[model samples]
Structure formats: structure tokens, C-alpha cells
Target: MIEKIGFPLVLFAMLAIVLVETNIMTSGIIITIGLNLALALVLTQILALLYGFSKSLKILNKTRRHPLYSPAREASVNAQLRSLKK
Candidate 1:
């Protein structure tokens, strides 16, 4: 599902709104907490994607050292390596 709203932001907004409606917190407090929670939630997703991409790049770099990395370098190259199967 496409999340139009992040869970954290929704949760915070709900709680803040409820508190204000109940006279537990003021509207000013809701504005403060809601904005910060939204920012933090978005940053979390951004950082997760950044780290995941880094890990993928590292795996590709490591695999490039393997002989099978490029199976069809050239016709002669494959002939030189010989078939792994007997």
C-alpha cells in the first residue's frame, strides 16, 4: 500500500489532537510535536534507503572479484578458463 502518511506522524497527530480536544494539551503543543515528529519520520526513511543502497553497492563490489562475475568477457576468455563441468 502507498502510505500517504507516515505511521509515526499519524500517531503523533492523533495523540496530540486528542489531548487538545480533552484539554490536556494546548494547540500550540500539538503544532510543535507534530512538525518535529513528521520531520524525524521522513528522515528515518531517507537514511534507511541511503544505508540499504550502500550495502547493495558493497555486495556488487565484492562479487566483481569472482570469476563468474562476467561470464561472457569474450569467446577466447571463456575458452581459456575452460568449462567448470567435466
Candidate 2:
């Protein structure tokens, strides 16, 4: 499935900072929260990228021995391997 909310926390924290900066928000606590939040979200994205890369590497390693990935070899015949008719 696709990730519609990829890095949502990071985006929300950034927007919150923008909202707080224009005096539209009166809460002083949000400034500290937003700054820390932005840093945290940045780290989260980095970790997500690392995890995805690692997973892909593992999958590629596991699939390396599959028939489609085997070293090229001449077949006994080049005819169709099977009929596709219904």
C-alpha cells in the first residue's frame, strides 16, 4: 500500500512553527515544542530511509538465487515453455 501520510509528523511540526511565528498563536509553550518537534521529525525521516534501504537490500540478497536471476544458460529448446490459451 502507498503511504499517504509519509513523514506527517515532520510536516505538521513545521507548519505549527510557521503558525506560531506570525503571532496568530499566543501560546509561548508552542515555540519550544515546535523547535524540538522539528528536530525530532527530521531524525524520524532519516531513520525511515535507512530502514527502507536495509529492507530492500535484504530482499535483493534473498532473491539473488531465484531462477529469473540465475546466471544465463542455454535452454534445450527455444520453443514456448507453455500454452497460454484459456
Cα lDDT of all candidates, in order? 0.72, 0.70
* TM-scores for the candidates: 0.49, 0.52
lDDT of 2: 0.70
Estimate, for each residue in 1-86, the C-alpha lDDT of model 1 and write its tens digit.
32755575578866765776677776686667875666666798899999999999998788777777774665666676676443
Candidate 2 clash pair list: none
Query: Best candidate, lDDT-wise?
Result: 1
Q: State how far residue 79 of model 2 sits from its true place (Å).
A: 19
Clashing pairs in 1: none
lDDT of 2 by residue, 1-86 (tens): 22666567567688778877777874767667777888887888799999999999999787776676643332322223333331
| Minimal lDDT window, size 10, model 2 | 71-80
- Number of backbone collisions per candidate: 0, 0
- Report the number of the highest-TM-score candidate: 2
Candidate 2 matches the true fold with a TM-score of 0.52
